[model samples]
Target: MKRISRREVLKTTSHFFVGAIAGAGLNSVLQGCADTSSDQSAIDDIMKKTEMADIKNIKLTVLYDNVLYKKEMATYWGFSCAVQGLDKNILFDTGMYENTLMSNMLKLGIDPSKIDELVISHDHPDHVGGAMMFLENSSDINVSLVKSFGSSFKKEVKERGLNLREIDQPCLITKNSFSTGEMKNFTKNEHALVIRTNKGSIIITGCAHPGVVEIVEQTKKITNEDVLLVMGGFHIMNDLGTKTKKIVHRLKDLGVNFIAPSHCTGGEAIEIFSKAYGPKFINSGVGRIITANDFI
Candidate 1:
């Protein structure tokens, strides 16, 4: 495994979740349905949904996990992200192993009780695998664990007396944060986090099995803000020479400013991004910390 810093690992997994690969199985369903031509009108609508002044001092920290680092992280860890501020600490996804996630959080100085909310990106083990551990850590607080499905994990949560909200409908978590709520339109029952930030809306995804492109476009539809940063697994590593280039161009055309592709993103894709985005492309790894403050 590459010697990735903890901060790098954290930011890469800021959007950790399980999703299907685009053009692999669900491409036809996603491609034929939406007219890309209408994207401009949609952008306009998104801009109209909120005022720029509404965004404030929101800070996100790449907390724990591995898949976001591209290399099969040491097997001691999985993929997990910690979001701080906004009056709540929302943990997006948990890695495959509970011990690794817990130890990483401890080494990184994150307390589970400080986490006000827990959101699951999908049903995959890597994403929700550490839920029971998280709940066990925060037994004192009425922490809210949100997910689209009433996963068997729900039983574990309820059995432990943790508050679990099986979200079937889209709902707001904070002043400007929104959840995709299972994203039944796509496979893997994946969900992503859309956060309003000072620069613009930051969309955090896990695995992006539903298609990274589709995730970004859907976030634009829901939040109506120019995506400032998209950091997480793109699940597109097979052909970096051509496909990554196309995706980068599309993201540019869509007005995305920063991208930190990790986890399932192969080396070739990382190379393409490093050449294309340069400094804007972050190198993520376990034990590293990244935030908007660090950017400025």
Candidate 2:
């Protein structure tokens, strides 16, 4: 494939937004048709289901994290991962630095122009800082963020003519894949990912401010499947070892099969989880690449 330069992407950006608006108009018309008849709704449902691929065929790559899994990749105080081998190449969160994110992508052979969609867990700088710069001239314009994001951030996205998807409830992001929605609680309102697999369900979070265990339990309700693996930052950097141990026990009690905690999960928490889950603890960090083969 021909690599599209940043200049070329900017030149074509206007056309892309126009096409998106036209497509939205088309979808609105179709939505009315499907709403008026049960058969149309059923057919739409089948089409959506057909787009889904089995989890065993999926690959998850940690593109950006505070820890380094590959010696050549740089690490920053943020999180970003790529979910590929599905209907769309989903880019989850953008790390703290633009150069680091792009350079790492180049090293990993991830073409920016090929990303089909972007999912932002929350509005934190670590999670969204690089994205702001990455989106400045990129071809990928579709972004899904929680509804609670600040007006300035939303305005910036709209001003750039990007397709802003403000999700307030748990919804199907792709076939057989879901967003745990905006986890409304004590911490920053966040959204975690839930992908239903043949084996069970996989949950991916950015910071998991509401609690990783809570997010996993939420996935059970969202996808109606047993928890398979949970990855990403747990945001328990300040938790005491005793507290972390109890949290680990609770996660096991909830039937969590595997874990790959990193970033803000803290050393104490990571150690507790590592000891508890044993071999099931998959090390997570920048440059960590996980595929269906790791689980199934």
Among all candidates shown, the one with the greatest TM-score: 2
Q: Estimate each model's TM-score.
A: 0.73, 0.81
lDDT of each: 0.60, 0.73
Error of 2 at 235 (Å): 0.9
In candidate 2, position 5 carries an lDDT of 41
Which 10 successive residues of model 2 have the least lDDT summed? 24-33
- List runs of model 2 lying over 4 Å from the truth: 1-52
Q: How accurate is candidate 1 locally (lDDT)?
A: 0.60
TM-score, candidate number 2: 0.81
lDDT of 2 by residue, 1-296 (tens): 12224343233311211111121111111011112234334334433553445776788889899978899998889999988887778889987766799988888888877787788888677787667554566543577888886665565556556667776666556765667667886657998877777777778899999888789877765444578889999999898887788778888888888899998998888888888888889988999888876773
lDDT, residue 14, candidate 1: 27
Worst 10 residues of 1 by lDDT: 25-34
